[model samples]
Every structure is written in structure tokens, then in C-alpha cells.
Target chain A: MIKRRKFSEALFKALGLSALVLAVGTLVLLFGALLIDGVGRLDWQFLTSFPSRHASQAGILPAVVGSTLVMLVTAFVGIPIGVAAAIYLEEYARRTWLTELIEVTVTNLAGVPSIIFGLLALGLFVYMLGLGSSILTAGLTLALLILPVVIVTTREAIRAIPVQIREAAFALGATRWQTVADHVLPYSASGILTGIILALSRAIGETAPIVTVGALTFIAFLPPSPITDQPPYLSFEWLMSPFTVMPIQMFGWVSRPGEDFAANAAAAGLLLVGMTLAMNGLAIYVRYRMRKRVSW
Target chain B: MARPVDGPYIDSAGRGDWPKPLKAETCELSFYYGTRLVLKRVSVPIAECNITALIGPSGCGKSTFLRCFNRMHDLYPGTRYEGAIVLYPDSRNILDREVDPIEVRMRLAMVFQKPNPFPKSVYENVAYGLRVRGVKDRRAIDEKVEQALRSAALWEEVKDRLSALGTSLSGGQQQRLCIARALATDPELLLLDEPTSALDPIATASIEELLQDLKRRVTILIVTHNMQQAARISDWTAFMYLGELVEFGPTKRLFTTPAKKQTEDYITGRFG
Candidate 1:
């Protein structure tokens, strides 16, 4: 009997190890292929110049700029609203049927298809609101797509804080706001940041939602200068300008019947993966600092 | 043993000085968490500059009773407080809706069962109460932080490393740091809910010794499960059973000759 149990354990161990190896090995192969194909194409000029009909002359400048601006909008619009909703749900809201319903809905929302969010943005922000195929509409759509992820992560972070810590603060005569501001927010900051970055990274690679919201596959001109030489020295005109993000641009290149376009798509894919990894690295660094200070 | 009629049980048989002057007293304080009544109508007197320890078995509402003094129960919804926790000098009913819980907490401080120090520096942890109260002057905050740490008997070990994170300390040191945080505001009353329950024996001993020194200035009310700890540290003791105050008297009298049978049974380890 013992021999049989040992054999079973060994078999399970081997199965698990094989599974892990398969998954990691696939990722390594894909990344290695992208590196080999795209490395020669990457250059300063390729980054700085705009896209063209000629594949060799094409640069990801406009697409890169578009993605950055859209992400900025998503972070600005989604993060505060998501964080606030989470705080309200976790801290202030009483446990009732309505709150429970809301919780269930939010959890389910995170699992909803990204294309569904795109359709919603198409109907609401595009046609109904008359925002057209602009940067703002695409940003708002991505924001909606990631809202559930942000809220879920923020709530998880807030919930992880020990009740004793809150009691200690309250015992010191801190008001609810004071306690949240001084202890809760500062302590949960790393977890919230990790969640935010993860959500943003997820939004960055999204193509269908931005496409549904009316992002152009090809764009030559840049959005209006955000920093004009005017007295205010700031502008919001770019928000309303037509845009194309990295994923959409890559998709357009990949569909073309040419080896050069395929290489272009590979380069863009490499950049997208790099961006996501950089975000994840930032999250890890932040979480490390927070964990060192505020452990229970 | 003589039982005082219609008031808190005070067995002043062995001691000549019976009343030590009331810092605060609860008048039939009953607490309810939703529909379940946790703390029944229990009247208890906290003597000024004296350490009163509430001893009871687990789930007997001793911790719940401790939380009542600072209106800590008000933090949650559906938990209700009935009756009065009247503070001296002002004689204001802290349980009254008119009286703010935050205001009551400012007058009193609490140390929890587990040491809960903020992730901030030792200096900032000690200065937390002052910061909440809006004491912004750097010199004043520095002086108070030192004084509070010294009062908690943690200054010598942590004086040079004031900027170190509070959680970086040993378990006992963290508890003492919590005590320092509570003391920084110079509260009228200090509430401790099993402050040393999570510590080692040596750390527990140090904290008990510190409490003895502290009772000279601040009135303390502590809830402890260890009967020996109550006997060693507290001047007054209240034995609670099933959410009711069974006996309240001087520590010496209560430990040796408890007026009630329940107190005797629990004290002698007959049953909890």
C-alpha cells in the first residue's frame, strides 16, 4: 500500500512539473522568436518617425504617442473613481442586500468580455455623446474595461489591513477620515498601486475595445501639441483628436501580405511586452517597500 | 465579607481606605451586538490613578466591556450601547448621542491584545496622537514623543533609533511602542485590552512593572485572562462571568476571599 502511494505521489509530481515546464517553455519560445525577428528593425529613427506606406520607413511614433495619451486618460479617469468606489464599499457601506448585490455585480464585471465594453463605448461615448473616434472616447472605454479590476484589487488591499490597526487609530481619538488618511491609505498604498498598474497593463494591450470605440488603424499626423507657447502653456485639444493605439496599429501591420509588415508587427509586439514587464517590475518594487514597513 | 447593597461589589474588608475616588463609573451599562446582548447591566467603578483589571474567560465580554469606555463599539453598525459611562470632573455621559465618540477617545487611550504599531518610524508612532490632535510644532512633537516613550520604558533602547519603523521591534517592544503611542496624547484614562497576552513571560513581566510605575499618574483599566497577572499588577480587580460583573474589590481581598462563589470557582480553577 505504501509503495502504491509513493508511486502515485511521484506520478503527480512529474505531471505538475511537466505542466509548469510546458507553460514557461512556450512563453520563452514566443519571446525568443519576437526578439530574433524584431531586434534588427528597432532603432532611434523607427521610434521617432511616423508610419508610412513603405514598411522600412514606418515608425510607431504616432501609435506610441496615442497609447501613452490614452493610458494617461485611463489612469486619471479610472484610478480615482475606482479607488473611491472601493473605499466606499469597503469602509463606509453597511453590509446590506443592496451592497451585496453591488459587490456581486462588480466581481462579475471584471470577467465580462473586453469587446462588450467596446460596444458600450460605441453606443454611449461615440454615437450618443457625439465624441466621434477620438482619444477621449477610447480612454473612457478602456477605463470602463479596467474599473472592475481596480476596484477588486483596491478592496482586497484595504481588506487585508487588520481590524486591530483601525481600532488602535480610533482609540487615539482619530475620526473616520483621519484614521483612513493617516493609517489606512498609507498602509494600503502599495497594494492599491500594484492593482492599478496591473489594470493599466491589461488595458494597454486591449485592441477590440479601442477599435469598437472607433480608433483608426492608420494615422499619420500627431495629436495637437499639448504644450503650446501660449500663456497657459497647457492644452486639452489632443483629448478630442483622432488616435490609434499600439495594439490596433500592430494588428493592421500583421494583416498585410508582406514580410516587412510582419517584422513591423513583431517589433511592436516586443515593445508591448516590454511595457507590461516594466509596469510589473514597478509594482514589485513598490510592494517591497510597503511590505518592509507595514507588516502585521 | 460584606456586600454593598445595590451598587458595585466593593469588599474593603482587608483595606482601611475603601474608596480611592472615582475617575469614572458605569451605571448599568448593557451592550448588544445586533440582537445578542453581550454585556449585561454591569456597574463598575474605576478608581483614579489605580490599575483595575477585568478578569474573565474567553467570550465572556471582558474585552467588549473594555471597548465600551472609549465608545469603540460605535464604530460598527447595529451594535448598541445602553446606560451611561460617566467621566468625572465633567460628569458627562459618554454614551450620550450628544457626546462625540472621537472626543471621548481623545480623553482616553487603548492598547490592544496584539501589539499594533503603525508602519511608520518609532518617533512618528509615538507622535501619532499628537499629530491627530494637530500639534504641528516640531520641537513640541519631539519633546512629547521622548516623554511618552520614556513613560512606556522604551526610550533608552529606542532613543537613538527613533526613525526606525515601529514594526521592526520585538513583540514586547512593539506592545510597549503601542503603549507609548497611547501615552503621547496624555489621556485622562488609559484602557488596555489584554496588552501582554501576545507577549513572552519576560516581556509580560516588564509591561506589568511598567504599569505599576504608570498608575502614579494615569488611571488604567486593563482586561487580562491570566489570573496571576491580575493579582501581580492590578490594585483593583473585577471578576466577570457570562457578561456580568460577579465581583469588584481590592486585588488582595478579591484574590484571597472572593465574596461570590463564581469568583472563587474561577480563581481556584474549578471551572471557567
Candidate 2:
């Protein structure tokens, strides 16, 4: 019996190691291929320039700018809504079927595919709301796609907070909102921030939803800045301006007949990977600092 | 640094101090966590300016009884309370359906066994109570924080590091900070649930000494597992067994010569 148990244990270890190798090995190979193809193509000029009919002249400036702006809008809309929903779920919501229903919905929504969210944006924001195929429409759609992720992370963060902190605050006569806004939220802020950054990174790489929302495959001009002035003025019309993000641009390139555009796609892919890694790094740092700050 | 505290202390000390002004009183109070009745009908008088210690073995509902004073159990739904917890001056039944737990908590502050300080500077931890009560002036907050810390006997240890995070302190210091936080608001009653169970011997002694000093200023109700601790600092001791009040009286007499057979057995190292 002992010999049989040993054999099973050895088999299990081999299976687990093979699975790990398969996953990591694939990621490394793909990243290695992108590095070789894209490194020579990357440059300040390539970063600064806009797309062109000639693949060599094509740069990802508009897509980069568009992605950055869209990500900002996503953060602006998603984080507040997500955090509020999370606070209600974890703090204020009584243990009732209604609260349970909301929780179940959020859990299910988190598992929905990104492309479905794109279709949702296409229908709701673009067509029904008459927002057109604009940066705002794409951003709003991406925000919807990521809201579940943000809310899940935020709820997890708030839930992980020791019950004693809440009890301490309430014991000192803080109202529920005061306890949450003053003590609970501040303590879990790093976790919330890390969640947001990770969610934004998810949105950053999303191509299907942005494309589904009708972002142009190629764009040569920057969307007008959301802040500009004739005098003491700011403009929001850029929110309605057409745009393309990095993944959409990259997808467009990789699908073309020519090898040059494929090379262009590889370079854009490298940049996208770099941005995602930077965001993940920041998230990890925030979590580390928060852990160091709070012993309990 | 002066702030208004509980009014007119009629000292509840000395055997013949007749009809002490009560801070709070519980009458036939029982508590339930769902359908399970954890605290049987318990009646006890909490005298102003004295420390009343609740002593019992684990799960005897001493903590639950202490939490009843401030309605701490309100955070969880389906946990119900029976009978009355009356605050003396207002004579309001704190368990009344219409009473706000928040307001009840303001009048009665609490500290837990484990020190839980917000992830802010020590100064912020003490000032939190005042800020919640709308004391916004920075100078006033600073003064009160200092006073409260001083009252808790932690000011000397933490004076130079007020800006340091509350969690940065030793476990004992953090517990003291929690006490200071409670004191900052000057609640009429302070509830401590095993405040020193997590502390080292020296830390426990310091807190016990502080508690002795604190009883002269504000009424305190404490839950302790240590019989000697109850004997040491508490003016009145109530012994509980199986969610029922076994006996209660002045601490010295209760420990030296308990009234009931159960109390005697429990205090004499017999099976709890």
C-alpha cells in the first residue's frame, strides 16, 4: 500500500510540473518571438509618428494616445462605481436575498467574455445613446467590461480587512458611512489601487471590445484634448471624437496581407506588453507597501 | 485641553456609600445569536466612577453581556436582545427598537483584546474620536489627543512619535493608543473586553494600573478571564457560569469568600 501511494505521489508531481512548464514555456516563446520581430522597428520616431499607407512609416502614436485616454476614462468611471458597489456589498448591505442576488450577478458578470461587453457597448452607447463610434463610446464599453473585475477585487480587499478595525471605529461612535469612508476605505486603499491598476491593464490589452464598439482600424489624427480653451474654457467634444487603441491597431496590422504590417503589429505588441507589465509592477508595489504598513 | 465628561460622579466606593449614582443598569437581559440564547437573563448595576469586572470561563457570554451595553452586536443581523439596558441620566432603554446604536456607542466606547489601530499616525488615532464628533480645529484636536494619551499613561512613551503610525508601536502601546482613542471622546462609560489578554506581564500591569486610575475619572466595565485581575483592579466583580450570573459584589470579598458554591468552586481552581 505504501509503495502504491509513493507511485501516485510521483505521478502527481510529474503532472503538475508538466502543466507549469507548458504554460510558462508557451508564454516565453511568444514573448521571445515578439522581441525578435519588433525590437528593430521600435524607435522614438515610430512612437511619435501616426499610421500611414506604407507599413514602415506607420507609428502607433494615435493608438497609444487613444489607449491611454480610454484607460483613464475607464478608471474614472469604473473605480468609483466598483468601489461604491463593493462598499455596499461588504459593509452596508444586510444579509438578505437581495444582497445575495446582487452578489451573484456580479460574480456571473465577471465571467462574461469581453466581446459580449463590446457588443453591449455597440448597442447601448453607440446606437441607442447616439454617441457614435467615438473614443467615449469605446471607453464606456471598456469600463463596463472591467467593472466586474474592479468590484470583485475591491470587495475582496474590503472583506480582507480585519473586523476589529470596523468594530473599533463604530465603538468610537462613527456612523457606518464614517467608519467606511474614514477608516475602512483608507486602510484598504492600497488593495483597491492595486486592483484598479490590474483591471486597467486588462482593459489596456482588450481588442475585441474596442473593435466591437467600432473603433477605427487605422487613424492618423489625435483626438482633440479634453481640455482646451478659446479663453477660460474646457471642451468635452473630444469625448465624442473617433479613435483607435493599441490592440485594435495591432489587430488591424496583423490581419493584412503584407509582412511589413505584421512586423508593425509585433512592435506595437511589444509596447502593449511593456505598458501592461509597468501597470502590474505598480500594483505589486502598492500591495507591498500596504502590507508593510499594516501588521494586523 | 479641557473637555466635558460624564457629569457629577457619586463615587461608588466604600462599603457604606449608599445608593450610588448608576452609570448603567441591565435588568433580566438575555442575548441571542440567531436562535441560540448565549446570555441568559443577567441583571447588574454599573456604578459611576468604578470599574465593574465581568469574570467567567470562555463562552459563558461575558463578552456578549458587555457588548450589550453599547449594542455592538447590532452589526450582525438576527442577533436579538431581550429585556433592558437603561442609561441612568436619560433613563432610556438602550435596547429600544427606535434607539440608534451609533448614538449609544458615542456615549459608551469600547476596546478589544487585540489592539486595532487605524493605519494612520498615532496622533490621528487619538484624534479620530474627536473628529467624528465634529471637533475640526487642529489645535483643539492636538490638545485633546495629548490629554487623552496622557490620561492613558502613554503620552511619555509616544510624545516624540505622535506622527508615527499607530501600528508601529508595541502591542501594549497600541492597546494603550486604543484606550486613548476611547478616552478622547470622553464617553460616559468605557467598555474593555479582555484588553490585556494579548499583552505581556509588564504591559498587563501597566494597563491594570491605568485602569485603576481611569476608574476615578470615568465608569468602566471590563470582561476578564483572570480571577486575580478581577481581584486586583475592579471595584465590583460579577461571576458568571453558563450564561447566568452566579454572584456579584465588591471584588475583594467576592474573591476572598465567594457567596455561592459555584462561585467558590470556580474561584478555587475547580473545573469551570
Candidate 3:
């Protein structure tokens, strides 16, 4: 009986070790494959030059610029509104049926597939509003796709704040708004920023929604000039003009039959990975600082 | 013991000796949570710059009654109250539907049982009340924060680390820091609900001493479950039982010879 028990315990330990090894091995293999194919094709011209129709002529410059623009626009449009909605729901709203319903809706929205948000943007911005398939429409779609995530993360961050802090603020002759702005918001700012970065990272890699919203597969020019033009300027108008982001261009490359196209796809994937990793690292660092600052 | 034949004790309930008029006057104030009534119709005159201590057992209504001063009862959805809580003779009654509870809180400051510093630097924590009041001058803010910290007896320890976070302080220091935060606004009345209950004996002694010093400048109403604490710090003591204010008088009389049997029994620990 003692021997059997020892054998079973050993078996369990072995199983656990094997599971961990498998997970690590899978990640390393995936990264190794990407690097092996991607490192050979990467160069300054590839990064700085515009996309071309031929595999030899193609570069990721326009796609990179387009992605950066869309990501910034998405961050600007999504973060404040998401955080404000979260603050309102968590801090100010009474526990009525309406608030409960809103909470439920937000949770459900987070679970809804990203593709649905794209379809919604297509119908509303493209067809109904006549904004057409442009960078603005794509950004808005991406923002919608990630809004619930940002709201949920921000709400959790705000909710983690002790009620005593709010009480202390109120006890100091501060109005409710004052208490929220001065005490609650400052304390939660780091956490909220971390959440925004994470949400933006998620938005950056998304291709399904933008695709459904009709993101251009190829574009030769940068966005319409943001400041120089009046209304509807194509030179810097991210909101109104056709644009091709890195992920969309990468998808097009990967689907083609040529080895050069596959190499370019791998290079673009590497860039996408680098962008997301940078965002994730920043989010993690901010979260760490916030933890230290808020530590009791 | 002989009662003082002279001084304001004889006219304790009169209007002329009262300073700042009455900010809040509770008459026959009784509170109930569900079917359990926590405070009986207990009347007490809360005077400015005088410290009043409410002493009772664990379940007694001292803390609940203290909460009533700022209309904090509104925060809890199910808790209800009866009788009158009149605010600043000119303002509407607290129980009236028209009065905003937020306005009441703006006049009264409260320190809690535990030290709850917001997750902010010590400087930000002290400047918080001032900033909320829209004081924009950097020099004035720096001066007021120093003054408030000094008054709370924490400036010497914290002056160099003003930018350091509030949570980095020792437990006693955090409680004192909270006191400083409360003092920054110069509130009409300061409510301390077992402010030292969670501290060690040494920390408790420091907070007790600070409370004694603070009473000379601020109107203080403290709720304490410790009979000895009530005796040590309070100028006047109000003994409560269950939900009723059994007896109230000078601290010496209340501790030495309580007016009611319930008060004596509670003080002696015969029964809570």
C-alpha cells in the first residue's frame, strides 16, 4: 500500500512538470519560427519605403504609419469615454435596476466577438452615415471592439479603491465631485492608464473588425494632412480617407502564393509583435508602479 | 461631590453661552436599522471648541449617533431615523427632503476608527482638502499643509518626506496624519468614531493625547467603547445603553457617581 501511494504521488508530480514544460516549449517554438523567417527580410528600406504590388517592391512603411495613426486615434477616442463610463457606473450610480442592467450589458459586450462590432460600424459609419470605409471608420470600429474591455478593466481598478478613501474625502468637507476628482481619480490614474494601454494593445492587433468595416488592403499615400486641410482633406484625413494598416497588409501578403510575399508577411508580423510587446511591457511597468504607490 | 455653583455649568443648556449658535441640534433622535432601533431619543448640546465623549458597550449607539451629526446615515440605504436633526438654525432640518446630505458633510469633518489614508503622497493627502476648495496658490498651500501637520503633532516626523506616500507612515503617524487632513479644512465640528480603537496601547495613548490638545481649537465629539478612554480625554461624558442616553454630566461626576443606575452598572462592567 505504501509503495502504491508513493508511485501515485510521483506520477502526479511528473504530470505537472510535463504540463509546464509543454507550455514553455510551445511558446519558444512559435517565437523561434517567427524570428527564423522574419529576421532575414528585415531592413531599413523595408521599414521606411511605401508598399508596392510586386513582392520584391513591397514595403510596410505606409501600413506602419497607418497603424500608428489608427492606434492613436483609437486610444484618444476610446480611453476617456470608457474610463468615464466606468467611473460613473462604479462610483456614482445607485444600485438600481438600471445600473444592474448596464453592468450586465457591459460584461456581455466584452464577450461578444470583435467581428460583430465591425459589422455594426460598417452599417452605421459606412452605409448609413456615408463616412465610407476609411481610417476613422476602422478606428471607431476597433474602439467599439475594445471599449467594453477598457470599461471593465477600469471599473475593476476603480472598484479596488477602498471605500474609506471616499469617506475620508467626504469627511474633509469635499463635495462628491471633489472627492471623486481629487482623491479617487488620482489614486486610480495609474491603474486606468494601464488598462488603456492593454486595451489599445488589443485594438492594435485586431484585423477582423477593420476588415469588415472595409479597411483598404493596399494604400500608396499617408493620411491627409491633419492640420493643413479644412473639412475632408485626403492628405492627412485619417477619418475620411482610405488607409491600409500593418495587420491588413500582412494578411494580404500571407495569403499570396510567393515565398517573397511570405517573407514580407513574417517581417510585418514581427513588427506587429514588437509593437504589442512594447505596449504590454509599458502596461506592466505602470501597473507595477501603481502597486508600489498604492501599497499599504 | 458638589456641582460647580458658578461658571457655565449652571447654564449649560442656555443659548447665550453657545458659540457659533447651533450648527446641528438633535432632539429625541432615534435610529433604526431594520427592526432594531440603535439610538433612543437622546438629546445633547454639542458646543464649539468643547470635546464631548460618548461611552458605551460594543453594540451601543455611540458610533451611530456620531454618524447622525453629518447625516452620514443617508449613505446606507436601509437605515432609517426618526425625530429632529436641525442644522444651523437657518438651514432646513436634516430629515427634510430638500436638504442635500452633501452640504451637511461639507460643514462637519469625521475621523474614522482606522487610519484610511488615500493612496496618495503625504503632500497630496494634506493638500487634498485645500485643492478641493479651489486654493490655487502654491505658497499658501505649502504653508497651510505645514501648519496643519504641525498642529496634528506630525510635522517634525513628516516634514522632510512631504512628498512621500501616506501609507509609508507608522500606524500612530497615519492616524495623526488623518487628524491633520481633517484639520486642514477647519471644520465646524470634528467627529472621531473610535479613532484609536485599532491601535496599540502606546499608539492609543499618543492619539488620546492629541485629541486632548485638539479639543481646545475644534469642536470634537468622540465615540469610544473604552470607559477609561472616555474618562481620560473627555471634558464631558454621555453614557449610553442599548439605544438610550442613560446619563450625561461632567466627566468627573459621570465616572465617580453616574446619575442613573444603568450608567453606573455599565461603567462598573456589572453588565453591558
Per residue, candidate 1 scores C-alpha lDDT tens digits across B1-272 of 11235554654343332445889888888999999999988888889999999998999999999999999889899999988888987888899999999999999999999999988899999999999999999999999999999999999999999999999999999999999999999999999999998999999999999999999999999999999999999998998989998888889988998877889999999987
lDDT of 2 by residue, A162-199 (tens): 89999999888889999999978988888899999999
List, residue by residue over A1-296, the lDDT tens digit for candidate 1.
99999999999999999999999999999999999988788888778878889999999999999999999999999999999999999999999999999999999999999999999999999999999999999999999989999999999999999998899889998888888889889899999999999999999999989988889888999999899999799999999999999999999999999999889989999999999999999999999987876787
- At residue A101, give the lDDT of candidate 1: 100
RMSD (Cα, Å) of candidate 3?
4.5
lDDT (tens digit, per residue) of candidate 2 on B47-91: 889999999899899999999988999998899999889888888
Give per-residue CA lDDT, model 3, range B12-127, as digits (tens): 34322333444555677888887788887876656557778888888778889998877787776678888777655465566666767777776777889999987678888888
lDDT head-to-head 1 vs 3, winner: 1
Off by over 4 Å in 2: A1-18, B1-19
Please report the candidate that would top DockQ against the real structure. 1
What's each prediction's TM-score? 0.96, 0.93, 0.90
**For model 3 chain B, the run of ten residues with the poorest summed lDDT:** B1-10
Ranking by TM-score: 1, 2, 3
The CAPRI category of model 1 is medium
Off by over 4 Å in 1: A1-3, B1-5, B8-18
Ranking by DockQ: 1, 2, 3
